[model samples]
Target: MHDLEASLLGGDRDLTLRDLADRAGPGVRPEDVQLFWRTLGLPYADTDERLFTDDDAQAVARIADLERSGRIDRRTAVTLTRALGHQSERLVLWQVEALVEDVAQRRHLDDISARLVVLDRLTELAPVLEAQLVHSFRRHLAAIAGRFAAEFAEARTTEQADPSALPLARAVGFADMVSFTRRTAGLGSTDLSAFVQRFETAARDIVANAGGRVVKTIGDAVLFIADDVVTGARVAVGLAGELGGELEVQARSEEGGLTEGHRGVTPVRVGFVQGRVLSRFGDVFGASVNVAARLTDIAEPSTVLTDPSTAELLAGDSRFVLEPQPPRELQGLGSIAPVLVRQA
Candidate 1:
């Protein structure tokens, strides 16, 4: 076990948990170190157990420095640590599993052998993946900074706003693939992967071109946001129309297997609403977000639906023809009428 630990960590194997804490220097509280460990999703180790390395001590020291400098409070530190832990854990699992599956299929190997292949490849892949993550994060951070700058400049021109109020009033929406489970039933890995990739890529392109941002893509749906209602409406309408067109084109194409006769194509339904939303961790949440999701569930394929409030706001738009749908009972939301939006 000690030899394995030495080989894996590539460091002295005699440092206990308490020894690591002591190496972090003074003014780093015991509780703070424990909290950091727990936030990183690590189980508690006995204080006397040699389970940590010098790198771990350095990380704790860096976190302590950040906290001491007032750059991050205790709560924020925990949140940051937890986010890193949770997101990285999921990402690492996903990447490793994808690699294992590919190796298993290509080499006709058993599961254990495939995993061994993954382990062999990980050392070569880790640094590349880390660099890519950092590069992507920097680019994303730049975009976020630019957005905030533009938004703050706009806010300065507004009248009598509370300084502490959240800065953005955005439109949030959801677009869900209809009959997803039924459509993808009995599909092999390659076919299913292509289908989902096609949908997500198309959805993202549609949203971006319509001046909206895709917040995230779920298996059979996407969540998006835009700076204003008009942009949001355009995104919702474009997603449905464009996806529908893709399906039609696929149905007409003479490709084989799943691509034949729209066997791989899926129709999408969209719902959008304009309101103030709370943005946290690159995701939006609020009543409007819930309403948008609910509306998408009730929308028909290749169509867009909006709440009455949103419809009222968009009443006079010439590009859209709005039709009133009968009010129906919705779970959790109770009875409500939704407006069907058609592109003119």
Candidate 2:
């Protein structure tokens, strides 16, 4: 066995499934152990195969301790395990791919060669990357805790809010990139990667600077949320004006014309709303989210739009002008007047 693999596993893979269950202490069923493996996005293991290690046993034991102590429920434990598995899977893939791309770029290697080089260097890089991941996890956790505190420090009881409606009253928005498919129809891998990374980086930066949280970046759009409508308005306007306008000017510039890279792919249409939304599984949902998306579809390039209800809320704010547009029928959302929002 490789030394680095052994170091990571805490020993050779000498333990069988049965051995793992036995070492996990009392009340740790073998089936539950299998469930744990499955929840970690691994396949079910044979009972007699020596495919397990001390690290596996230790993880099951620790979770067993928590369960026995009543600190965590079995269902939630599984969910939490799945969360770690899912997120870590994506995170590592993204991190590794970025490393491969960087290495390929620097050394002028092809895809397979870059991958081989990356595989050889990963064990050495793993420790450093793991430390950074821990640091980032801690920082993000602290930020979430801080947000929770600020949100609930002076909150009203649940019953005081509309019982039938979604619990959280948030500002939801979407910024849809105009004609994304048309813009990059035949781009190669490097160009495509750069295009996506650039958009995501810019969108995330805009959301953060505008007091909004990016829910996620869809392939052709980004979803953002803010604590209040005004903040969401700022987010919406920034995506439309700052990001989209930047692209529009690029499309017309000497270096950014269609003959160059797809710098001509310009402008994003933004839409936002102030309403109750159900926040779950790292995304938001509700009428507001739906309306925001629908409005984005109808918005012109480099423009921001909102429902009348949301616009009315921002109407009193001096930072924006609410231009009322005629009612338009949105698929599954009925005919609704879209109001354009722009900075004063």
Candidate 3:
């Protein structure tokens, strides 16, 4: 086996496309295997080359078994395959790049050599990564299951007892770095990466500690959501006040340490809204998301803004103070008043 194939397939390059299909047992057609392969985001060719592995064959066989047992229909099977493919493609690339960057920095190697080292390291780390992935998937699945169970119980006890009408209420928010483009315009790759990493790490820590989950991070902004308004409020306030203040202080302390033309501090503006959101594909959407993002666009550095609805929800809470802002016309969203929030 060639080095690349051996490294990737773990020396399992004995089976061809035809052989793999046969090994998947009866009722599993070559076309079915092709479909599975394509659904996994892999390009397929009609050659009899020994390019497939035992693991690949077994995986296809398991899918066939699932279909035969009626555990999943063909459409569902394809969806599951696509989801795994889509997510894993990005996951593997991110992990590999991270490893390559570490190797390059630590050993002072060129990009080519760094990639070669990363490929070698991956062969050794693959099993560990796989195990960790499985472990984390189970833990996350358990959390989702527990949440659904509790929500279903509550729904059953409610007067309506109708799941369709009462969608899940959540607090969605955005925290955006101020003047990100101008701040990083002169930074080299290394410095830019460091700056982004610092912001992302700090933002994630603050959001997680405040009982909110980060949905995603754009280049200069983070989107987060919480099951309750109070938790979201805490996250917003923490990011704008505590975390933002700390970064500012650090920037001042390290001002002399920075390279010329590089900014030391990352200031962020945050906005939050509490309302029902349409959750799909591990992302949240709808007007609440739009409003929160719009509010973030208008918020000043180290400050949090919320819509009237969120302010009302948080009004009775002594931990926060809300001051109403003048009605401002937002693009796409009509004229609306927002409230500034601060820790009491």
Candidate 4:
């Protein structure tokens, strides 16, 4: 009773931590209350400092109750805070217009007009969007971490993979839109928006359907990697074909005015190479990856090209027809002859 009294009337009614404990009821302990604030990364004060307002106290008390009920822990609470902070930093840095546009669509507003409104009301009207973005960022980070842990753990536990794990051979590939800069420049804002969206959609669908994992999407291209050479070959072929078809469709559409007579919507040139790659930070590296990207750069529009190794691996695959092109003096890479693929 004395402690409760000390808390309630304590510190000249400044609504400090002690006062918060007093309002939390007789059953709630002050230690747990303090821990709750600490978990929230709020400063702990011993003096008669008004660190927590009534609302803050109530929130802490509720969180404490949730903790006691096995809903969360001090560590988890801290992680949530850190994760939220990191996500906020990224959102502020990127100014991702897609996020704002998504909210606009949900609210039945025109995306373009809503973009301006979203910019103006970001701090107020889009709390839900912000929260969702935070949640997504956390989930992605966790997933990536989990995958890394699993891979490393497997490497350590299995004699076949060693503590450090020998790098495994994989087929790496890249598909990039040719003349993307020129095409985008020729487009209006609305057309440019649709063009980028259609390209991404097509790329993702093609990559996944061909049993390849999309590593990342640069502005006008996507990178993919597959475990086997055959899968990589199929991925390249499928991606090129899909891009060609989509480009044709897009060219006929009004938004595709930039591609009306240019054969296709900046046809994606794909290239693949089979070799060892280092997977880290949700990305791949090594010479093979580099070569694949360079190959994509040199490939003709709407075509799939592959290094000699990848072509050799898929030589027996009757579903594909491969034809070699003349040796080109690729920069950074010595003389090389790449094979182009066609449907059989």
Q: Which candidate achieves the best TM-score against the true structure? A: 2
lDDT of 1 by residue, 1-344 (tens): 45544544656656766776777777775666778889998876777877677777888888877888999998898888988888878877877778887998799887899999888777677778879989988998898899899988887798855656554689999999988888777666655665776788889999999999999898999999999888899999999988875442232222333445443456799999998788887578888899999999899999999989999988888988899999977679999999998888
* Per-model TM values vs. the true structure: 0.84, 0.91, 0.87, 0.59
Q: What would the per-residue lDDT of candidate 2 be over residues 11-125, giving only the tens digit for each residue? A: 8989888887898888887888998899988876688888889889999888878888999999988988888888888898999999999999899898999999998887789
Query: Could you tell which candidate, 1 or 2, scores higher by TM-score?
Result: 2
- Give the clash count for model 4: 0
| Candidate 4: residue 321 Cα off by (Å) | 1.8
lDDT of 4 at 192: 64
lDDT of model 3 at residue 261?
A: 43
Please identify model 4 stretches exceeding 4 Å from their true place.
Answer: 1-96, 102-166, 246-264
- Residue-pair clashes per candidate: 0, 0, 0, 0
lDDT of each candidate versus the true structure: 0.82, 0.85, 0.83, 0.72
Task: Please list the residue runs of candidate 1 whose C-alpha ends up more than 4 Å from where it truly belongs after superposition.
Answer: 1-14, 105-111, 160-167, 188-194, 245-262, 315-319
The deviation in Å at residue 120 for candidate 3 is: 2.4
Q: Which pairs clash in model 3?
A: none
Better of 3 and 4 by lDDT: 3
Tens digit of per-residue lDDT, candidate 3, span 1-344 = 27756766656577777876787787777788889989999987774876688878888888878888999999988988987998899889978888887998899888799999887777678889989999999998998798789878886887763466337788999999988887776555656676787788899999989988899999989999998899999999999975465332122123324443422556799999998888766678878999999999899999999999889999999999999999988789999899999999
Poorest lDDT segment (10 consecutive residues) of candidate 3: 247-256
- After superposing candidate 3 on the true structure, give the runs of residues whose Cα lies further than 4 Å from its correct spot: 1-4, 16-27, 47-49, 159-166, 246-263
**Model 2 alpha-carbon drift over 4 Å, by segment:** 156-159, 246-262
Clashing pairs in 4: none
